[model samples]
Target: MKVTQRAKWRYQQVRQARRQIRYKFKPFKHTRVTRRALAAMVQRVVDQSQRYTLRAHKTRQDEYKIVINGWPDAVQVTVGVHSLSFLVMQHADFCDFLLWPDCMPRRKHGQWRCFDTGCLASGPYHRLEDLLFNHLAEPFLEFLTKVPEQAQLMLYDMEGMHHACVEAVKPLKRLDRPEHPVVCWPLPAGSDIV
Candidate 1:
């Protein structure tokens, strides 16, 4: 018996279909971090701090707002199993401050796009904990304490602040700095932030 070209092509198609079905039903190995767990982590960090009075309140099913008393604005954080998003809201405008697991491409105007499942990294919980303490909380506290006035100014001038922040971060990307410490904001002529 001779196998014709048509038979070979049909065999390949069937094999491909089976592979697709297997992938569609494959059990996900990595467990997802719950919103409540993420919120509790934030609370622990806030409790340890002494500088600012920060309170984490659950505003939605998957979102929490960190309210800082005596501050001009509130920080909104959304947590996912694989990603975290930080935003600051002032009046009616908002700023996308940072995105964790920094693998996703940034959108135009310096905003970060959502995480892609294909870019998921191992030990997401550990990475997120580090980011929460070092990247999100530490820099945020510094921004409030070191330059309280500047932080307020940024909230007022959202567009200019965003542009400055985008420009400030461009050099860091090229330099590949491990820690992001700068909070770029508008300043008077001949004045600089050190």
Candidate 2:
């Protein structure tokens, strides 16, 4: 077989092996101490963020912006209410599921409120995961991967969300209008998750 084909086969074999290992030791890594420790670290890291002004005025999406870490260039991305914590949960896919305690959304009288921390009281949220995987995450990843060089995605979702953790960066355009970030949060009508 060709070298490229052989490499592909090897990659598949490695992926399968990893999946099996994860399935076997799935019960581990779930502990209160571990969760608190992780959260504390992430909170400290986020506190170090250099405040960047809100670019040209836009809606809440663009109005609230915090640039993600690890970009050599000054390409700014909108930091949705809980983007950091959300990214953390996404990255912790190594485990069965991420226990994000403070990522609850509160909707009161038809308004979606952003919760940075604390137990939220919201109801009738038919599309909870949809909002993240579809509205926020897809566009965020799209913008993150367009850079010339690979950048690191720091996630900050521990017990109470006190520390930021660096996550993976893959090349996949999940957004359409990279030039227009204000409209990127919602992504397109048929936005998808890879």
Model 2 over residues 1-194: C-alpha lDDT tens digits?
99999999999999999887773112223245333433343333344332211122123521233334333122333333344222222233321111222333444444434343442443334433333333334444444334222224333323333333223443234322343121111111111222
| Model 1: residue 3 alpha-carbon error in angstroms | 12
Q: Candidate 1, after superposition: displacement of residue 138 in Å?
A: 4.9
TM-score per prediction, in order, is 0.44, 0.21
lDDT of 1 at 159: 30
lDDT string for model 1 (108-180, tens) is: 2332232445543322333344434443445454554444233422332433444122122224343233333
For model 2, what is the alpha-carbon lDDT of residue 49?
A: 30
Top of the candidates by lDDT: 1
Residue pairs with clashing backbones, model 2: 39-162, 39-163, 41-163, 42-162, 42-163, 42-164, 43-162, 43-163, 142-174, 155-165
